[model samples]
Target: MIVTELRFENYRNLKNNTIVPAENVNVIYGENAQGKTNLIEAIWLFCGGHSFRGSKENEMIAFDNKYFRLGMNFFSGGREQSADIAFGQNRKQIWINGVERSSSSYLTEVFSAVVFSPEHLNLIKRGPNIRRRFIDAAICQHRIRYASLLSKYQQIINQRNALLKDIRKHSELKDTLAIWDDSLITVGAMIMKERYDYLKMLREPAKTYHHGISAEKETLDIEYQSTTKTDENDDFGTLTGKLRAAFDASQREDFYTGYTSVGPHRDDLDFKINGISVRRFGSQGQQRSTVLSLKLSEAELLYQKNEERPVILLDDVLSELDNSRQDFLLNKVEAYQVFVTCCEESNKVQLKNGKVFYIENGVVK
Candidate 1:
């Protein structure tokens, strides 16, 4: 998918601006905090119905402004389409092809975007929640039902944790805990099963991409870490039984800690390089390569599942990589539409066909 044009009003530091982006590679260059990232953020929000930076709709509006508006024209699957998203302190709406609609209804219909930022380097070394979020977000884009399942699983976990906490003060509530346990096992088991299936599909692509980027010297392996041990080929019935048994064993400890301990929420993804844990043993370059491989793998997976490639969003990430790595990234994304930001044109790696937009003081020139 390619974005033909974009218009923004009262968005971040940009008051009112419009530009037509190149289909292949569109480059935005400016100094720090000069609206380069804000432009890309607007495109990402249009694609995903939310901010890649985790900002709320109101937070994305311009300073002292009451509302913000962003509209984009896109070409995909040999057809032209347009979408607009508007939001204010109290209201938000989305329009597709000139028809007003709910944001969630058609959010994923226009396009898919994979964002790379310097902060993503933490995927391997940071806490487990970040890694889990990465997987969940990718899965939700391709499998819409996964989002509802995830929400239900989280609700059940919250209820189960509350019940565990109450059990400490009143032993009588312990019997009522069985109801929450049943709910947790049902929803949590489905979540775990879906995650396991997704991970299985992710392994081969991720390993191949990692090897290509690392020149075959380093081997990357990803393992899904669950609270209960189960074979890779185990069905949901067996896995659910194991999860129930594990939860039963951990009930007392969970009550003491005031949290449900054994479920998908507590699970993690493990990355290893050449038989060593990437988080503890890999160098900085290795960690960066691992993250890049994972993202590229995601793009490939999306393309394989859907015939069209996902759009690429590079948020000042190329500036942090060496020229060799930058070249690899640029070459890999040659076929898809890419939006990249940098401090200046000279800092960007050379590309065959790209349009450069100079951003200065919140204006695109």
Candidate 2:
């Protein structure tokens, strides 16, 4: 998808203005705290997901303003389309193609995008929750139903945890734990299967990108660490059985801790560089490259599955990289419509051919 026009009003610190970006690459450069990243966040909201920066809906409005509105005109599914978001008085309204919608989820079917920011550079260095979130979000891009599945699994976990806590006090209620276990095993197994399959597909493209980024000096690997045994020969039924066994084994522990512990929620992804754990030993550059590779691979997989290219958003992620790495990034993104935000005017020179815009105090000049 390509965004042809973007309009904003009272959104963050950005001035009420409209921007028409180029079809290929657009480099947005400006000084620090001048709303370069805010522009990227605006486009990302069209994806129907929450702010990648984790800002609440009320927090997105400008100071002293009760609401914020973002609109975009884009080409998707072989036609021009438009979407709008208006948030105020603790209410959010969404519209696509001039038709009103009840929820933002409808926007995902119309627009898809992959975003990379400095916070993602810590994907390899951070805890397992971040890695799990990355994998889950990538899967949701293509598998829309997976999002509901995740919600169901989390609900099951919460209910099961409550039961376990009650079982701790009422010994007679222990028998009912079996029902929650059965539900957890069923939903948790499906979640694990989806996650495992996505990580498996992500491995190859991620490896190729990492190899090119490293100039073939190092190899990258991704392994899905599941709570249940996930051998290559295991199928969905086998996975279910293994999860059931795991839940049975952890029954006492679950009651003692008053939480469900053995499920997809406790799983993680392990990134390795040359057979060494990237989280424990990879350099800063390696961590950054690894995240970029995963992100690019996500875009590739989305295109492969849907036959539509998702917009790429790079939010101030080029500062710490060397010239060669920067060149690789620019070259790799040449095939897609990408928006790159930077703090230096010279960064726009790196893009051999593209549009350039400058932002000063929230106004694009």
Please give, for residues 192-283, the per-residue lDDT of candidate 2 as tens digits.
87887887799999999988877788789998877766653478899999988888888878888998887789888889999998888988
List TM-score per model, in order. 0.88, 0.90
Q: Candidate 2, which ten residues in sequence have the lowest lDDT sum? A: 345-354
Off by over 4 Å in 2: 64-67, 88-91, 347-349
lDDT of 1: 0.82
TM-score (C-alpha, index-matched) for candidate 1: 0.88
lDDT of 1 by residue, 118-179 (tens): 78888988999998998898888778899999998898888878878888889888888888
- Please list the residue runs of candidate 1 whose C-alpha ends up more than 4 Å from where it truly belongs after superposition: 63-67, 88-90, 102-104, 169-179, 346-348
Looking at candidate 1, the ten consecutive residues that score lowest on lDDT are 324-333
